[model samples]
Target chain A: MLHFKAEIKENIPVSKNHYLLTFTPLAKTPVPLPGQFYMIGIGNSCDPLLKRPFSILTKSDDSIRILYRIKGKGTTLMKEMKTGTVINVMGPLGNSYPIPKKKHTPLIIAGGIGIASVFYLAEKLKGKAIVLYGARGKHELLMLDELRGLVKELHISTDDGSYGKKGTIIDLLNEFHVNDKHLIYACGPKGMIRAVSEFALEKGLKGYISLEENMACGIGACMGCAVKTLKGYKRVCKEGPVFNIKDILW
Target chain B: MNLEVSIGKLRLKNPVMTASGTFGYGEEYSDFVDLNSLGAVVVKGISLTPMQGNPPPRICETPCGMLNAIGLQNVGLKKFLKEKLPYIRNFDTKLIVNILGSTVNEYVRLASALDEARVDGIELNVSCPNVKKGGIAFCADSRTLGRLVSKVRKSVNHSTLIVKLSPNVTDIKEPAKAAEEAGADAVSLINTITAMAVDLKTRKPVLKNITGGLSGPAVKPIALRMVWEVSRTVNIPVIGMGGIMNAEDALEFMLAGATAVAVGTANFINPSSTSDILEGIKIYMKENKINDISEIIGGLLIDNPDD
Candidate 1:
């Protein structure tokens, strides 16, 4: 609920048009939860009045980082934002992933850009997590070394065989020996989520999935980002951008 | 500072108003904002009876705007008066009820009910573009628009009646003049424009309703143009709104001849936008040495209509 003029610390192009922009908050940064997101805007264009939601990549005192891909006009403009330029940043909004108790082993699965949210989750669960990541190619598979440093084991998969296993991330997860003793967390393409959701259910594993939707108010007011669930359609920005894999209708 | 504003004889605590539909009866945003700071809250479009509204995929994003096919989804007038009005009155802000009816009688009935409830004002929402029936949206035609307003005017004795005009018409001035001729106390112009979006992969319209009203920064220019046009065409005060996200945008609407502007899609971006716009207006007024906000109404100089 606070709007601070943040200065861009760096905007690094990762692969193709994807970028990781780090910003220094002009105000006291709220302690955000894992899997939570922030709404960011470029300049003063009401054309994109609504802020673009980016997952909290990582955070430090007085600063926060966001990883985004150039998908549309808003992201395109965001890529051009120069270092030292100030932009409006709001929130550590939406619910975060629930943390596990002592000595809990959690399996984290992510696909492509979905890896952004899980990076922080791995950092939060350091030494007590296993990571399974998938991307289209070697270059698209990001944060492997960083995640490898934190997890007990890091599993990798690529569609083009340019990386570890030659199949979807779900394929890699299926190949790996995982049991009900471990809790699972995933974020990525809807197709991948649908695939892995079945695997989690078959194993009777408790898991959480982060869903993406075209949002108006990142807050609860608009009701623009309602996702169909087992109970009913709920606001993705409020009731959850994160939900139990079992609660999801997909 | 006493930050209240007035719409004709009705006094508002501030110049911030919740545009119709987006605020959902002022009860929804109460948790996020102080209702008293707002000039007035215009609730969702009300019909004679309950409406289920269009099916989903009711909203889609365009270039800079979003198309919504809420279908004037309302709780009807009787339920609104019996349940909704009392709750709204409990809030510390002025409530300007927005009414939509398919016939003149329905409009009169809805307006009379609001008068009986002793609400602040009636914003005749005759310009709803999401309906498929005749008389459901009277502002599309000059004669029907006049008839609807006149009927409500005759029935409501004390409340100020405003005819909200439609932007879907060829000439917005025609309807504004019609409402004024029919004895409307004031007029608001430029409701959402008729629009549709497509899903390229599915080869189908993105929205389930096929067509929806477009709003946000994309519609600001067109809204301002129509507000300027309608302000010149009619004698009544014009409350202009469309894509007003900041003080500058609000001032643009005022300069285009809107005495006060309503914040719609911008509210979706920031829950505190209404209060922000009100504060922004005050800053602009002090910086420019302007005492009254009405001085800025219709301040934009147009050498020719073609511009």
Candidate 2:
């Protein structure tokens, strides 16, 4: 909800085609929530016109991290940036993970790059959650070493059989026994989210899902990122990038 | 320090109005921008009925600008008055609603509906299709523009009618004169230039709608040229826009011929863009020892060998 200049401490490749950007705030800010995001922009350039929105992968007292893959024109510029570059970041935007009132078994389900938003949620749970991550292959399963130490039980799967249990994350869900009393949290591709939402609903587990939609203002002002819910069209950047699975129409 | 300038009967506190679609009814950036400090806040396009905009991939970045096919997505007139008007009325600044429709009757109906409404003015977006004429835009043809605007001008009694012209036309002056002759109090341009972006990988257009309206710094020069041309042809006040991101850009529009300028796509770049531009204008006026903003309007220098 605040805008400040943050200097990039580092932006190094963490995995194939992925980078881990670490930046320190030029101004003081309250600690961002687990699912909050930042609208990051390079200095003065107008071509990429608007700042790109990225969820906070992790954070510490002096620095914050964002995980991104080179998607288009904007990230292409980001990939070549040198360290110590001053990036204009408007953050900790959007709503956060639905923290339950009482402690219970937390099931963190993530697919591919969706793991960027969930890593902090795991930290908030104090290594007491069970995380299930799915990727196309072993190479795509990013931040595994860092992620393994954060969760109590870490389950991984790769479609090409180069890693643990082969198949989609949905197939992994079928193999694993999700406890009846657990609360579910999910993020990933639309199909993956839809399947997990359906799976969680059928299991009668309370859950929230993070959505990825092309955004304009990233802060709900533009009304560009619209998602149809039971109530009709709502802004993903405003109403939520996070929503209860039960309330979402699809 | 006197920044107030009159656009017909409507006097703005300053010349900075947040462009339609960029400001989002003044609620989205209320935390970041001081709405009351602005001269005006123009909300997005509202049609006769609710509209679901184009499918995804609606925006694509270009060289110093961006193309968007939001397709004028809005809550419709009924919903806008019911759900949005009350919230907008709370602001101390002038409120101008930008409205669009497919036909002449729709414009008149909307004009009649808001004639007595609490808002200050109405900006007609003539960039939309004239459905009765098989989707030719009202702004594209001068006669159609004259007919639709004059009929709309007759229906609204309490509000100033400002016609927003598109730059897609060949001779922008023709429509500006047409609007003036049809009783429009003021006119604003250029909505956006028609353009397209292609994805090299897919070998297809980037936006779902193949083409969209381009806005931002890339269109500023083209918009300035049109504003200069239209202002000379029409006696009515001209509100210029297109790639107006900063106070310098606003001053450039004013110097060219715009009575007022709206900050458009820059709102996405900086959430507080409106306020920053307003502040910059104030500083410029102060440093220049200018007492009033009117002194700077149409102050451009054009030279000829004879002179």
Candidate 3:
């Protein structure tokens, strides 16, 4: 991991309450993996003290992208950031989703803003994976055009009937023929993740899920951002922002 | 300019140190900071056994600061001495172990073990509740704090004995004097002030622990006042900390009577805060034509012509 300044190339709204921020590193940085994240510092100020952790949405030759929703004070400040402004970034943090086995086909599941964590994986898998993207409504869904072109099959769901299929992402899963031959990779709200975990376990499928938590130090130092696992409590920032669905106690 | 400062018999090359629980075991920020450049590196609180700490939502950001209730999770003493100690031994800096315990004997044992390990210093984290004393914090009562300090002081032969004071008290001076009277070589203040944040929409506390210690620029003024009061009350060196984000803040503490200052929450915001603050302090001394850093200690000029 490294700490360096990166200049913003773009900070544009992608959908209602969602933005796609792109920045280029001034110094060389290691290539971030699918589920890995970066802690982006806001304007140099004491209030809003800690940097906010964001999952890597995409990475190109010279730049990286992060998809964020303006949830609180930090993200609200991040929205006001303009192009060409410099921000401190520490990155390629936490573990990544393991590669799919030869026998198992990849099933990428993303809910709302959680799409940020799985987008890179979908892009990397390209024509080899099927993606199930869900949001509250049509306005909340993001990167549909890009996702359609990247994955083998793209399925979408919305809580309101304004989008593809009505009901939660779990209801949308009923339409697909999933089995042990499929490896589920998911990132979403706790309810969605729990449902995915149960779905995977009942289907005798193995999978991984990415988690989100309020973090400080984004490194292992603070021992904040803890999540319970069968072994005990583990740091979401270190032991994971990603974990095996089977290992999770819940 | 001379930046050297002494904490008890231990002389620091500079007056800047990394606060416990913020810097990890000195390895987490090694990529961003030069460990050798720091005056001291105080690791996270070590207990007799590994602690799982609080459940998720362990930390939350508040205006100008953050609240953290990490529950002092650590690798336990055995793992620390075996794995962590050797890793940090690579750094050319003094290592001060901040210890937390539920009983006086626990503190004594930790102090003597760390001293035997030949560490540079041992800081007693008196903010932890003394389970033996009905869950009241060791620093909550002056006499209890005195007894704890005296026992740990006797066990600590080589390492400098420093008592870390909590600001959640009626009068900070009482505990400062109690520590000195009990043979503590130095005292550091203030550990984070207890505070909480609530989610209005959900009507719940932000942290799973309900309340966490508040640390950052928000607590600076309170820390400064407590440091000033404690410095006047105790004869031993006062190591001030709690919201020291920059050189100006550190200088403010020194002028208010602190011999040294520790950088805590700033590390979360900027990994290289300690080095940056240290560099800033040197520049301040050079620009002001101050020769020795000791000149800044207790340097506040108070004048009352009417008196």
Candidate 4:
């Protein structure tokens, strides 16, 4: 619900093409909950006209962190910014991950830059959760030091054998003995999330999945990010960026 | 500073309104902006029956705009009347519902159902293809657009009718003229221009629908030109929209001929865009010492002389 220029406190390169940017608000704002996102307007031109959506990676007392990968022109512009750059950001948008009422083990699933929101979700969960993170290689795994202290358990998978188990993260599912009793919160590429969602359904596990789609208004105004479900189409920017796996129609 | 503007019988508090499909019922961005501060709110396009719409990837960002083939996906009449309308009725701004249908009867059905409700106006969508029209949009032909507008106007007598014209047509003025002649109170343009994009690496269409409507700042110039042309062709008021991101952009359209302006794709960049544009317009009016906004409407001065 805010749009202002935030000064980049630090723009750290986490890995190849991936970056972790932290910014301090020039103005006061409310704290963003985990899974919430911001629409970042790139530069001052119209070439990358649409503000790219980025999830909250983590937040401190005064700074908001965003984790991103250089996938296209938008991110390419982001990667070139220096530490003192001021960027236009509008935020705390869409629904946040709901705090579970019932007592159940939290199983965090992250794929690549999908790891953006998990750190905050884990902090809220507070060392009561287990993390399953997947990347292409060792260098792709980000913020391992920050995550290790916040979670009770951590599992890793790399597509290339240069890191952990050399396969998709879905291959590492059995180690957790995942079931209806465990809660699964996943974010990743569609194929990976789909496989995890199907596996979760098959095991009768319950959790939410944060989806990504090309969008216009990150708010519900533009129906650009509609995701199909049993009910019908829902806006990924409003009704979710996080939705119950049981409700989504793959 | 008399910001009031009108379209037929409906008078707005200001000339600022959010374009349909961009503001999504007002409440979505209510947290970011005050809904009562604007002139009006045009909700997303609604249909007679429920629509599944086109599949994902529904949108792709182009140079300065984005292309989307949402296929006018929306809650049906029953759900909207039961669920959405009541919630929207509570907001302070004028409520204009943009409606779409595959056929003439479907349009009538939707109009009749929404008639006499708390809604203020209905925007008929003739931009997209109809099943009965064999893939041609009604607005593509003046005759068909006139027939559809007249019939819908007859069926729904309670609210003002605004015809939203598509920009893809070769001559936008013809459709605007047809709507004006067929009892439409006003006309709004331009609906997204038909466009498409591709993924060079994957060698596939960027949007699953293959082609979509292009909208955003990229379409502003073209939209301004069309709004000017339509304003000259039609006798009724014109609600201009395209890539109106700020007050200056809105002012350009007003001077061109649009009595009112709607912020479309710009809403995505800032949820408070409508009010921001409203504030911008007020600032401009103050800076120029203008007392009334109507004086600027259709008042663009051109230096080119007739041949």
Interface RMSD (C-alpha) of each candidate? 3.1, 1.7, 0.9, 1.4
Residue pairs whose backbone atoms clash in candidate 2: none
lDDT of 4 by residue, B1-307 (tens): 8999998788999999888878877777877778888898898888877776777888889999988887777777788888988887787888899888778898888888787674798998778532232124788889988999999989877788999998878888888889999999999998888888989899999988888888889999999999999998888999999999889999999999999999988888777888999999999999999989998899899988874
Q: Candidate 1 lDDT, tens digit per residue, A1-250?
A: 3555689999989889689999998877678989999888766755555678899999878678888988877898889889999987777888999997665588898999998988899899877888889999999977777778888888899999998989888789888898867788899999999888888888888889998877776776555666667866676888888899888876
For all candidates, state DockQ relative to the true structure.
0.24, 0.56, 0.89, 0.71
Q: Candidate 4, what DockQ?
A: 0.71
**Per-prediction backbone clash count:** 1, 0, 0, 1
Q: Candidate 4: where are CA atoms >4 Å away? A: A100-103, B129-136, B304-307
Alpha carbon lDDT of residue A250, candidate 2? Answer: 66
Candidate 3's TM-score reads: 0.98
What order do you get sorting by DockQ, best first? 3, 4, 2, 1
For candidate 4, give the lDDT: 0.86
What is the per-residue lDDT of model 2 for residues A1-250, given as tens digits with 9 covering 90 to 100? Answer: 4888899999998776888899999998768898888889865767778888898999988999999988877887887777988888888888999875565688899999999989999988888889999999998998899888889999999889799998999999888897766788899989999999999888888888998777768887666677778777677777788888887876
Sum up the clashes in candidate 4: 1
- Encode model 2's per-residue lDDT on B1-307: one tens digit a residue: 7899998889999999988888887787787898899898899888889887766567777889888877777888899999998997888889999887777998888888887685689999887421222123788789999999999999988788999988888899999999999999999998878899998889999887788788899999999999999998899999999999899999999999999999989998888988999999989999999999999999999998798
Q: Candidate 3 residues A1-250, lDDT tens each? A: 3899999999999876999999999999999999999999998888678899999999999999999999988899999999999999999899999989789889999999999999999988867889998999999999899989999998999999799999889999877899788899999999999999999888888999999988999888888888889989888889998999998877
Off by over 4 Å in 2: A28-30, A101-104, A198-206, A246-250, B128-136, B305-307
TM-score order of candidates, best first?
3, 4, 2, 1
CA displacement after TM-score superposition, residue A132 of candidate 4 (Å): 2.0
Q: Report how far residue A112 has shifted in candidate 4, in Å.
A: 1.6
Candidate 1 residue B118 C-alpha distance from true site, Å: 4.5
Question: Can you list the residue pairs that collide in candidate 1?
Answer: B4-B13
For model 2, report the TM-score of its A chain: 0.96
In TM-score terms, candidate 2 sits at: 0.93
